[model samples]
Target: MPFRPDPSLPVPPAGADPLPLQGLTLLLVDDSRFTCDALRLILHRAGARLRRAESLEIARLHLNCYRPDLAIIDLGLPDGRGEDLIAELSQMGFAVLGISGDPAGRDPALDAGAAAFLEKPLGSVAGLVRLIRQLTTGIGPVAKGEEVPVPAGDPMALRDDLARAARLILAPGDPAYARGFVQSLARASGDASLEAAVRDSGTPFDRARVARMIEDRLNRLRALA
Candidate 1:
């Protein structure tokens, strides 16, 4: 199918570089609003027009209306697995990048016909840009003028991550869920100690210890003026 662009989507900034992905449109299909926001920040700064759909149905709607140059799909969607969508988009000839928090999902994503598989929570925006450059144009940096200087730490995203940690700590339902959140949050916060604590936290006692650790860290972050 020939690519189509949505008129309602905002174009890249006027002064932005027109190389790399300057004229391309990207669709991100993921359930997490926070993650979609992060992708928007990264891709928009890198010169691509961004559109987001939070579920598989919403993504289908976007596909029916407008065809994007590329789509980044999250495997564990609320409604359905992203692998299915990747197969469909692949059949339709769009370059699809499959992303997942679970490491085991990578093979299935590639088997479903994704051009590449990425693990999340991503290390940095620069990694994302580099992946795009590698995927689209073989080998090169982000094409000079298209580079966006990513900060060492984004206070807002970190704050949201902390809030999530607090909630997970407070209402511990599934151990796997809590453990997964701890891993992702730890990565986002760049807290190696916490990451090790959570990774080693397998037994009930360990989980309780991690919960206290999370609570303490959250409290410290909250108390900061």
Candidate 2:
């Protein structure tokens, strides 16, 4: 049975903690009515303005009507490949996050320039929030030359930054930033294999190892601070 989302429902509470996406409009692209409903609930709970689309064609229609700050796109859609939509949205300057049931399906989305890849039944709402915050706030212009210098001091902050960067690799609309973020993390962590993997796979070279290394590097940097 298809779940019909109540479009007339009032927005959820703002909550005690400040909503990261407060005041931002989000476009959610998915074929399933249930998925759209769930995501709308999440976004509504966070106080974000929500627009739902069931297919690429509908998404395009919504985009023409409203310019969203961010777009959450499902990899499979009835009209066409969602990767194509990601590319189109990137040109239009919308932040794109690709969500897929099959994690392996993330590859083409990443390649197409999605800002992040979120495997569905999205695990950590906080992580998604954090990634959104980072996307809205932390991203900067890509450095022109090779050998960009790591930001000085506060290893914990650096690690957090790197973690955000790792997540950004899956974002479909910002490949240049994603590439730079991965490269910077590799240089900061001084991990040869990590660097190699990032170069080879558009995804993080080794996620677990990179996480541990990020922790270790942050600790080392913190001891000095």
Candidate 3:
């Protein structure tokens, strides 16, 4: 089940904007009413204009009518996978976060096109707030102004290679193959933080676990893109 906020928690002050989220519009895609209600309450309190859809069909309708700066999508939907939507939205210039109760297929989701991934039993609301802020405003520690030195190979060639690797791992397929593909890309990306985390966690390679790792990589790529 999707996580819900505690009702007893203090509510936002009347007429006061939720810090860091004011003036933002968000799209939420999920099949669960409870999930939408819980997220809507939090997002609304943060002063976001929230648009919601319970299926991809409905979400497409909203997308046609509204252009949201950010989207929070659940991986499982009655009609289709959220990762598919992520690819579509990312291409359209919207930042996306994929939330799932079962992280089982997360790796493929990230490969398919999520900017970030969050597991169910949600943790600190502060973290979500911070992530959204960084994604939308490009105002986080990771948003350093320093440029990434171009690699030795042709930039387009490298990008195509990376994209192919991502597709091999993220497209719907056998779980074992997807896990290996992501691990290979993570190593090739030369992201020390991600490599270190993967080493420390030592979790068995699976879609969900790999998705979390790939999501981090995707965020870095998005920054560079």
- Per-residue CA lDDT of model 3 for 1-225, tens digit only, reads 223433443454344334457788888886544445556555654556777787899999888887888888877665677889988988887888888755565796688777888765344445666677778888763222222222222234335444544555446655443433333334444445644443343334543454465555555556776
Best by TM-score: 1
lDDT of 2: 0.62
Candidate 3's TM-score reads 0.55
**lDDT per prediction?**
0.70, 0.62, 0.60
Candidate 2, 23-126: lDDT as tens digits: 87778887554455556555565557778787898998887887888888887665677899999988777799998755565888888889888875564444
The per-residue C-alpha lDDT of model 1 at residue 42 equals: 61
Best by lDDT: 1
Please, what are the lDDT tens digits per residue for candidate 1 over residues 53-167?
Answer: 8689999998889888789998766467789999999998889999876678789999999999887666555567767867765767653433343433345556566666656
Every model's TM-score: 0.66, 0.54, 0.55
Q: Which stretches of candidate 2 lie over 4 Å from their true place?
A: 1-16, 139-225
| Winner of 2 and 3 under lDDT | 2
Cα misplacement distance, residue 186 of candidate 2 (Å): 36
Looking at model 1, report the run of 10 residues with the lowest lDDT sum. 1-10
